[model samples]
Target: MITRRRSHLRAWALLGALLGATGTAWPAEAHQARAQAPALCTSSREPALAARMSQDIAAALKDRDGTVSVAVHDPGRGLRCRLGDTRLYDSASIAKVLILQAVLGRAEELGRAPTRLEAQRMKAMITRSDNTAATDLWQKLSRARLNRVLREAGAQDTVLGHDRYWGLTRTTARDQLALLAAVSRRTQALDLMGQVVSSQAWGVTAGAPRTVKVHLKNGWLPRATHEWRVHSIGIARGTGTTGTAAVDYRLALLSHDNPTMRYGVRTLEGVALAVHRGLAGGTAARGFTPGHRISETPDGSVPSGAPGPLPPAPPHPPQEWGTFPGTVPPSRTARDRRRAPRRPRSRPSE
Candidate 1:
């Protein structure tokens, strides 16, 4: 009898050990997973808001390819949300924003606004996303000068691109958000960003209510490694709404490893929309009307030979917003061609 009782005890202990190893024990596999997975997003001011944003962000990213990072801030609401780590990515045309900031910083030291030449460069760099303007400003400032501005802005993790290739500077979403706060402190900076041409204002600005003024900048690049890098940073200031109803916030969304430019843009916008909704006190996210998807123009302009007429391209075929759309669109002529069809090739004197 004693031997049988001991044998039964030994079997029970062995079974318990196996169940625990497989996570099939009383605590349950689901519980173990929940414990192991860290929160993707967090809000310092509101836990419920953080939880909601985290869940929605995770849902939006389900099955989505590539690596993404995000940061959201609303000082008035005392809410902040962060997702992903501080992995670095190419700055692309987003360097235009940094260059403008550095110029403005220098002007501030001189106790004046941008010089006429600097003003022109700022307008082209921010509003038109012009590379020549960016390069001119970047070259005018020594690397030490630019680094000084970045350090003042609290962008500790950013490293400027080498050899005047300003677009290749490496940065993280956190650093971008910091730069935004620093830049926005100046009305001149805010005004320039707010005036970004309509064609270039799609990323963090997507699905935002017109009531909230959006000041934004976006960047995209393609390299042999990682394939593509796309990023957007914006401040959504709700001047029209009052109290808790206001949706005033700033967001930085960065991504890489996309298979194509359009893919990267879609990922950034999807995450942007998610952040917007999450920041709106958990309101339902608005849809980003399926317009045209832009193509490979990392300089934030229309590339040669896109599918349809650009900028306000046609509404059919459901294209993604790109750095081009994230910044130019197809021309009216391109749209006309896609709609009318190629009237069949002429045989001529064959």
Candidate 2:
């Protein structure tokens, strides 16, 4: 009887040890699984607002292909929304913004304002999207100087293009947000960016209310590898309504692998429209209306008239500035073809 009792106690002890071991192993396994899980999309705001924004943005991108990244900061509401914010995309003409920033910042460093010629080039580069002006300024500023400007702006993930190809620079939506935020805070840069030629202000501006002042830069390039890369970054401000002070927000949208430039534009505008409505508490009826046509000429020199015969060739062939992909809808004419400068035979990368 004693031996039998001892055996039973030993069996019970073994069972308890086995159960304890299983319990410990299960938590460790569960922890490992948790660690490997991917992060869900998120918004930093009141639960209701966050959910609505997240849902709306997701809906905007539901049928889209390729990759799109967005980052928005609305200090008035103490809110932020991010989706693939760190992903990199080709800068395209959008790099012109950094170029402008570099020129302004470098001017401050040199203890002098930009030269008259530099100011003209800056205006052409930002407002008009002039590639020749951009190239000239890029050479003058040099990569080292521009890199310094980027560093000072706290845009760590942005890289200047190699071989003087400013359009090919790699940058992230988050980094762009940092730069746009700086432009909003700095008076000098804001003045120049705010003057972005009315023709080029379409993407993010399409969603802004008329009362809100907008400063923006947009870029588009169709490359063999990615199909199309279209991006827009901007700052919007207006009077506040919901207990918040003045409304101030910055947004960065980047996309690639689009089937066409028009498609890309539509995608961006849709997302922008949703974001503006969600943040500004505006209804769809008050949303922005995109212009009927889009412009590819960086100089904003498209002639205002009907298409005419090709213009006599100039002394030097008109260098292609920032040319949007063939897929872009022909909207505005900066210059008449009969008098228009001849762009290069090869399509510009931008």
Candidate 3:
């Protein structure tokens, strides 16, 4: 299985490098005007808890050379730990989930089939990080609607500009967590994110344990600086019913302009490890307790038996500039084949 994964990685890597070398252009657009301005954060109950978490994160990130933002949402608590200013940081691929939410919301509003080609685009946006699809969805829903949805979802720091993937959207750790909490509740404002859990995009890959049911979205982008560093964000939802009943938790991280952490998958894995330990009992986490280990790779990288390849350039949304194999010439096949012309299963087979 590992060998097969290595092969898959190599193939994908080739596609990624080729796309990058060839230059798949993603243009920046102007920020859209929203129907109403977003509201500022007014309150949070877990301020003290959040402060401790922030201190821990700050210490852990002392020499990390990048800004780190973290938010934790347990059963009753919605707390965030932020080390840096609450200013918007580049969201990288994480923004795709927001774009996905907007796309799904539009689908719901239009009363159109969620399994249509456009819906497939939403899946691509989330699973594959297709920039063009994100852009298309952005256009379909309009910037105003996107901002309103995000604002209503409580992700105030998330602002969408016209920049292509890895460039346009900015978000803070606090806002990212707020968005995650909103999704967990299935609020009307965040109903679109429900599609992320129901979509079977994760099933296309391997490594995550069958016992774990993950509803997640990931994002990554390389820095334009000379170091050419990478930044990434991952949001996940899993229930203990799947495995390690104690593993139920929300994980989020923001690594700014990381020169050494170029591999998007590795970057996400690091964050996942910290969260898993915090939830599953680890000395690393000053507060959390220990649980069971379902699979070593908690960040939901390659599934079990999946081979590791040199990390490829960040995945681009369709139509946008960035490195995405499917959008490149010669390989007309979409990376997310499951989201082809037909509708896919609404849920993964249990």
Q: Which of the numbered candidates is closest to the native, going by highest lDDT?
A: 1
lDDT of 3 by residue, 1-350 (tens): 34433433332322222112223331111012111212111117755444444333323332233434445455434433333326456565566666666655666788875667776776656654556676666666667887887888877667675523323466776676666655555443233333443222221111233333345554434443312223333333343333445444454555544444433334334444444433333232121111121112222211233322324468866663336655544344564564467875599779
Residue 9 of model 1, lDDT score: 40
lDDT of 2 at 297: 30
Candidates' lDDT values, in order? 0.71, 0.69, 0.45
lDDT of 2 at 121: 94
| Alpha-carbon shift of residue 71 in model 1 (angstroms) | 1.3
Candidate 3 residue 336 C-alpha distance from true site, Å: 66
Give the TM-scores of the predictions, in the order they appear. 0.72, 0.69, 0.52
In what order do the candidates fall by TM-score, top score first? 1, 2, 3
lDDT of 1 by residue, 35-106 (tens): 344555555667777666765665565446677777888786576666554778878777777898889888
Top candidate when judged by TM-score against the true structure: 1
Off by over 4 Å in 2: 1-45, 241-244, 283-292, 295-350
